[model samples]
Target: MADDPRPAARRRRPLRAATIGTYALLTALALVYVFPFVVSLANSFKTDEDAANNPVSLIPQSFTTAAYQQLFQTDLPLWLGNTVVVTVLVTAGRVLFDSMAGYALSRLPFRGRNAVYAGLVAVMAVPGVVLLIPKFLVIKEFGMYDTYAGMVIPMLADAAGVFIMRNFFESVSPSIEEAAKIDGAGVFRRFWSVVLPMSRSALITLFILSFQASWNELPQMIISTQSPSLFTLTKGTAQLASGALSAGSQFPVKLAAATLMTIPVAVLFFVFQRRIMNTTAGGTKE
Candidate 1:
């Protein structure tokens, strides 16, 4: 039997080797990916001296929550307020406007549709960094500078989100839309009640993506406002990098600020993560 099992043995040898190599590579990559966040968490609890002394330790010799305490007591609350305002306005506006525009581009019979889409693509191609100064200048010209409106409006209409939505709308069967029309449903009614409800998965995916993008956005904040009270978490965190918050080294406060900034997006990711995964899986299946 051993001599007769040569083909099976050869197959098993290659499979075993491939499996072992995959696990080894994945384990090494996981550690590499996780090490920085681990260090940040550990170092956040360390005193400046301890952080300096043991830069590489994951375990704190003495744990401290002072950084968090100080964070709550300082500009963190204000930054949190600003971030909430900007993110909510940006996400809501993007979802409503982007979807509407995308739907029109995909389904509605209208003139200049292709031109509009081409324009959006062109807008998307314009690198964001290049827009920093120009966006500021426009905000100033529009008298929106240093205002929440300035911060929220420029980012509300992202072309990428519109493109994502446009593709999704196009992917849906046209037969259902024709049926709705036959039932005497108006354009708005069909879209509002029928199509949108069917697009729950795509909408959720867009929501999660827009929330993450707007929440983590840093440069927009820097360019839009100068007042301390208007500063978002990203702006405040950038300030924390200057070492002005602490008498000497304030890594804890900075880390705590970053942690606080991370929480809302973290919560959002957790809540809607399955929808995101499902959307990706569905795309792969197609």
Candidate 2:
């Protein structure tokens, strides 16, 4: 009855303690990370005086929609429209181009394929800030500066998205493609009709990521275009934060813009977060 019961009990005691400690640490970290967002959301509904006086408070002293109304009266609608156009184009382009590049790197045997992939990986390691000047120069040289193309084209495909897609494509079974090949399906046909259909989770994962990245991208948007008509949400929001749209440290207006900027991406993520998790966990063969 008491055969080694103390030893087993003692072993479980440490594990239980460790688990509790881990949960406590994680809960603390979650609060730390989420506190800023909570404060921002709260302040968006607050009056300017209340927001400034109680910057970190989670409850507003007086709630009002004046900040949002002010935003709508400014260039916010134009910014939103431009952001939608650029984000939609960039997301679609990244999904298509990254998938094609990934498939080519994964399946198509070619000269310098490994070298190209290595270069792509290296590109991912470089900080984006380091490339800002170069991107600006390239956009200028191509005469894309101050144009919608400049804003959307430079961000159409990213190294990270390509890397993700390539990894996902590598996980797909070759046998499926081989069977399709036997039935006179060309590479493009196989990719478009066969492989792509089976890659729903990866595609959705890529779509969500691409949408978020393009929607929130600032440095690239700044370097890409200078036209007011081309101002995306990120760039416009930065201007609002800098007090361009109002005076007296308009925290409510700034936070309101930021809060609205977050909504679309947040909604998209909530809708497809499960698919993203599945893609990261593992792909299944059908």
Candidate 3:
């Protein structure tokens, strides 16, 4: 018996068409997403006149590092340092505090646990942007203005972080915690050694989130500090964008600052990216 070419051809036709359509759609989106970064990276090395004149050009009309040089001459370094400090502290604090509070809410049979969890849900509903003025008021009232403690302590714990941790803990099996509890382990000991270890995936997810949030945070920085020396990367970048200190004619400097500020986050996202993605999204196939 001879193979039927017609049926085989018919079977492959739909598959081939679907594959082609998927590739086409993906290619269009890739171009849309990557084109801007490509343009920004190219323009960063361009001279001010070149950047302005050839805004859309992938190639620089005149290549120069003067913009980068001038950024170093300004308060760029200080801003970068401030941003790093705050991001590190906030990420660490959120991971520890959120996890502890969450474990208590999820595992510990404490008084008013239900009410406390409900209160956190309510707090999370209140938008962060709307709290800027209110946060400033409290910070000033506590006389924590213009200090490192002020900038960090107020944001040390977030309601959303707690809620996320609580949800993640709930998703975990309670038997493991119960086993540890029956094994003569105290609450902190069981949580620190057993429960938290089991929650590595969730913790990594929270750490990445906290780092990104504190790093990109602009409004919080604005409300927290008034001194020029206390400015974070985002704060300083905005000031530069609005023609602060430097020659307004030059844009390479601003673009360079933007590009450099993006490096740490880009590196973070690249490293441990799979773990971060899987943890936040529940699960993914390789």
Candidate 4:
């Protein structure tokens, strides 16, 4: 019997239509998500009045870099430098401490391990806002207020990062670790030489998230430091947004700062996007 080409065509017609519709929907969502950044970039090139008057428009009547110049004139550079330092340190610390803690939880057998894991889950459930005063008091008690230690120490170990790494470590084959043990690799050596290297995807994902969170962190910086020299980009931008430096809205200047601050996060996301996608897909499959 001859195959029915007409019926196959009909079946493919609906599938193709659904695919097109899905792509159209995704493109629209992408545009919706992207329009604000586009508007911000356009407004950053416009004069104050131009930005205010044409807030949604992408074209500028008079393009200028005066906003950037003004930002550079202020302590924005210092704020950026401070933010870079804090983000780098916090990210590195989270990666190291969280990965180690996660490895311990997932691989090491100890008394009260389940209790510790439960406590971490509970801590993750707690709202960060609830910890503001407690964190502040601890920082003050330790004489860390308005200092880099206050800014960096509290963020070193994230509960979520530990949970993520632990789950990933559990998914890894236990046979590898058994072989390493037979070869006389100690715990730390086994983690560093075998387990950690295999967890690169998870690490990169953690790195991106930690970097982004610490980079855009505002509340912790607010509670931890008051000195202008210690101000991060988020704190400085908030001040700029509040019309502290200028009497008027000065949208261009504020947006310019925001745009600059966004660059590092954007770059990091793009660079690791492939690894992120693969990890997510692998997790979903598991």
Q: Would you estimate the TM-scores of all the predictions? A: 0.90, 0.91, 0.90, 0.95
For model 3 the TM-score comes to 0.90
Model 4 stretches astray by more than 4 angstroms: 277-286
Put down candidate 1 lDDT per residue, 167-277, tens digits, no spaces: 887777767777779989988887887777777788888899899998999999989999999999898889988765757677767776777777788788888877862
lDDT of 4 by residue, 123-229 (tens): 99999999999999999999999999999999998999999998888887777777889999999998998888788889998999999999999999999999998
When sorted by TM-score, best at the front, the candidate numbers are: 4, 2, 3, 1
Q: Find the candidate with the highest lDDT and give its number.
A: 4
State which candidate has the highest TM-score. Answer: 4
Any runs in candidate 1 off by more than 4 Å, and if so which? 1-6, 277-286
User: How many clashes show up per model?
Assistant: 0, 0, 0, 0
State which candidate, 2 or 4, has the greater lDDT.
4
lDDT of 2 by residue, 4-62 (tens): 78899999999999999999999999999988888999999999899989998888888
For model 1, the run of ten residues with the poorest summed lDDT: 277-286
Each model's C-alpha lDDT? 0.84, 0.88, 0.85, 0.91
Stretches off by above 4 angstroms in model 2 are 1-16, 277-286
lDDT of 1 at 45: 86
Model 4 TM-score, 2 decimals = 0.95
- The 10-residue segment of model 4 with minimum total lDDT is 277-286
